[model samples]
Target: MTLADTAAELRHLHDAPELLQVVNVWDVVSARAIAALPETRAIATASHSIAATFGYPDGEQIPVDLMLDMVGRIASAVDVPVSADLEAGYGDPGETVRRAIGLGIAGANLEDELKPLGEAVAAVEAAMAAADAEGVPLALNARTDAFLRGRDRPRATNIADAVERGRAYLEAGATCVFVPGNFGEDVIAELVAGIGDRRVSLIGLPDIPAPARLRELGVARLSYGPYTQRVMLGALQDLASDLYGGGVLPRDIRQLN
Candidate 1:
């Protein structure tokens, strides 16, 4: 599909009756493996996983150019739409997104990082504006750090904060508001209600409600952040341990790429 078409499809997927489940990929091999699946409608890149792959830490520690290079490679390798995790926008949300579009990225996650509401809204505006100037829909998943940063605040307060920030982002042209944290089903319901049906995105944290339950709760999107890479690494460790103990290597491994 053309970049424009892919972007529109990604935005449309947010309102789909079925929830959008994204298996985050960090590199070309992983991207290809997931893209080859019949059920993969789109792909999302985990910023943390990408950073770790390049020997950088998360939280935008990786240079924007380097991150874009990796995401570009993934985009070239996959046929489906690609949404990237641009954590906190690397302090330059608009320019970052513009360059990403140039690389054929269809969507992206721009984090608010609990910034002041006005500033956060401005970042969303900048990103969406850049996408507009480029004539791409760019499903901007504006994220709020309320719950992630407000672990100690009262539950009600955090929920209220998320709702406030989420509404503001939507008004600022965000395609969806990502409120990532481990919360009770009631909190999730409240978020969906406050944010709007099928307009709230979430991280698939361990032990959280299953995708079926999240879909039932009206979540538009769910993607594991760095957990995909973590699980893959854990498997590698297990294989190495077994090999060291004289266990035979399996010969039935299928070529994923």
Candidate 2:
């Protein structure tokens, strides 16, 4: 598919009757591995995972160009649509997503970092405007950090704030509102109701409701942030330990990529 077609496909997937589960990839190899799967419809890049692969810590610590270079390579290496986590847009939300479109990124997640609502909404607008200029649908997942960073506040407050921000972002032309962190069925229902069914996205954080439950709650999408890479690294560590003890390799290794 052309980049625009893939972007439209991504948007359609989010609104599909089934829940859209995207495995986060950090590089061309990982992206290809997931994209090669018969059941995989899309790939979302994790900023933290990509940053770690480049020896940088999470946050916007990695140089924006370096980060975009990796994401662009991954997008180019895959046939499925690629969605990237462009953390806080590296200080320029508009230009960042604009460059992403040029690199063939079909979708992106831009966090608000719990900024003032007006500022967050403006960021979403800027990204949408960039997408408009590029003429790609660019499934913009406007992420709100309210629940992730608002633990000190009341739980109700967090939900309300997230819902409000989610609505504002949607109005600003975000395809979906990503609300990461652990949430139960009731809270999920509230978010879905307040933000609009299939408009609230979630993360695969530990102890959150399973995918089946999330689907029941009307979630649009679910994605792991850095957990996918972390889990693979843990397996690698285990393999190294076995090799150091003269153990043989696993018998089921396949040519995934």
Candidate 3:
């Protein structure tokens, strides 16, 4: 599909009847593998996983140019629409998002680690302007880290604060509000209600409710984040450990094919 078509498809996926299931990828190989899946509608990148793959720490430590190159490669390798995890927009939300859009990225996840609400809203607006300049709508998932960082605070306060941020982001032209680390059904339902019509994106948790249940609670999308990539890396580590332990190879090695 053309970049404009893919961008439109990605934007539509959020409002589709079924919850968008995103298996985030970090590299060309992972992106291609997931893009081949019949169940995968769109490809999303995980910033932490991408940074780790490039031997850099997470939290936007990876150089912006390198990250954009990786994203461009993944987008070029896949037929599916690609959305990038542009962590904190690498300190320049507008230009960063403009570059991603130029590389054919259909969407992006930008986190706000409790920045002043005005600053967060401006960042979203900047990204929107960039996408507008490209004449394509970017599905901007404005993430708020309030819940993740305020676990010690009162739950209601965190939820309320998140709602406040979500509303501001949505009003600032965000395509959705992503409140990662809030997987509890009750809390999710409340957050969804508090945010009203805008979509809510959730992260996969160990105790996360089933997909059907999450849909019932009104979640628009589910993301595995860096967890999916970590699982594959963990298995690779185990294989390497056994390979160096002795001359004997593991008997149950599974082929990608």
Candidate 1 pairs with clashing backbones: none
Worst 10 residues of 3 by lDDT: 248-257
Candidate 2 C-alpha lDDT tens digits along 1-257: 68889999999999998999999999989998898889999999999999999999999999999999999999889889999999999999999999999999999999999999999899999999999898898898999999889989998999999999999999999999999988778888889999999998999876679888888889999999999999999999999999999999988999775
Writing each residue's lDDT as its tens digit, candidate 1 over 107-221 gives 9999998999999999999999999999999999999999989999999999999999999999999999999998768999999999999999999876569999999999999
Cα lDDT tens digits, model 3, 1-257, are 57778888888998876888899999988888898889989989999998998899999899999999999999999889888999999999999999998898999999998899889889999999999899888888899998888889999998999999999998988878999884567788889999864388888887678888877777788899999988998988997888798756767865543
Clash counts per candidate, in order, are 0, 0, 0
Greater-lDDT candidate between 1 and 3:
1
Candidate 2, clashing residue pairs? none
Q: Choose the strongest candidate by TM-score.
A: 1
* Candidate 3: stretches off by over 4 Å: 244-257
Identify the runs in model 2 with alpha carbons over 4 angstroms from their true place: none
Model 3 RMSD in Å is: 1.8
Evaluation by TM-score, superior candidate among 2 and 3: 2
Error of 1 at 238 (Å): 0.6
TM per candidate comes to 0.98, 0.98, 0.94
